[model samples]
Target: MADLGHSSDDTSVDSREENSSQDSKPEFSEDEETLISRMYNLVGQRWSLIAGRIPGRTAEEIEKYWTSRYSTTTE
Candidate 1:
């Protein structure tokens, strides 16, 4: 038979390595949670103006948090 590109075992090993790396990363702290909450509350309603109040918060972070919260609440 012709050789396959990769075996199932190789895929399993790659998945495990990726999960292990993700697990090692630091979790967000309470301050981060608060910032994310505030950001989500301000998204779209007042993006440019509210952003000035939160110095370190990013637009992407605000969007993600708002999306996550919206999904959770709708479900």
Candidate 2:
């Protein structure tokens, strides 16, 4: 009989929980925000390029944070 009461991927779940427990969100500074904004103005919607201009943030993270705070489209 299958053990439907528990997932077969219990180890995966446990590792995910452990990793999540150790993970911390990066603290973006006002200066970094200002730089991101300025880069947006100069480059428009280009997240990777903007991230290259800034430090300590991936393009995906920058895009997510920027889009969350500012709803306006880069177009």
Candidate 3:
């Protein structure tokens, strides 16, 4: 028999880490914001399309960002 690097603690801890990561919000840099704005003007509100240009970003997150950043009344 061999240890094979197996451990009960590994599986249990990994599941918790995955769940916590999903709950965390995405972070964007200043450069990313500028790029997003430029891309929006060029491509319009196609979130999935826009997301494809920005690596590691999803359509859902981009939509949320667009709404919060540019879709508000801001009165």
Candidate 4:
């Protein structure tokens, strides 16, 4: 039999706890909210070029921000 190196069962439990802790992080600040909103609006108008103009902004980040904003506004 080949020795397949496997992690202890505690690894899965530890990973789950770590993930839950990460999930409990607080929401973004107002400045982040504004930047995200700007990114989203720009994305809607110019899908290709806006990314280069905004530093540290990605399409996924823009989308997530927009979705969160939309959800909050609608509620």
- What tens-digit string does per-residue lDDT give for candidate 3 at 1-75? 244456656787899878755653545799878888998999999899989988988898887777866765756
Best by lDDT: 3
lDDT per residue (tens digit) for residues 1-75 in model 1: 223546766788999877854553323457765765676465644544444555665455445544554555642
lDDT of 3: 0.79
Q: What is the lDDT of residue 30 in candidate 4?
A: 78
Off-target runs (Cα >4 Å) in candidate 2 are 1-26, 72-75
Instruction: Give all candidates' CA lDDT scores.
Output: 0.56, 0.78, 0.79, 0.56
Which run of 10 residues does model 1 get worst, by summed lDDT? 20-29
Q: After superposing candidate 3, which stretches have Cα over 4 Å from the reference?
A: 1-25
In the range 1-75, model 4's lDDT, one tens digit per residue, is 133334555677799867854552325667766765686565563523544555665555445545555755642
lDDT of 4 at 56: 65
Backbone clashes (count) for model 3: 0
Q: Candidate 3 vs candidate 4: which has greater lDDT? A: 3
Best by TM-score: 3
Q: Would you estimate the TM-scores of all the predictions?
A: 0.33, 0.58, 0.61, 0.37
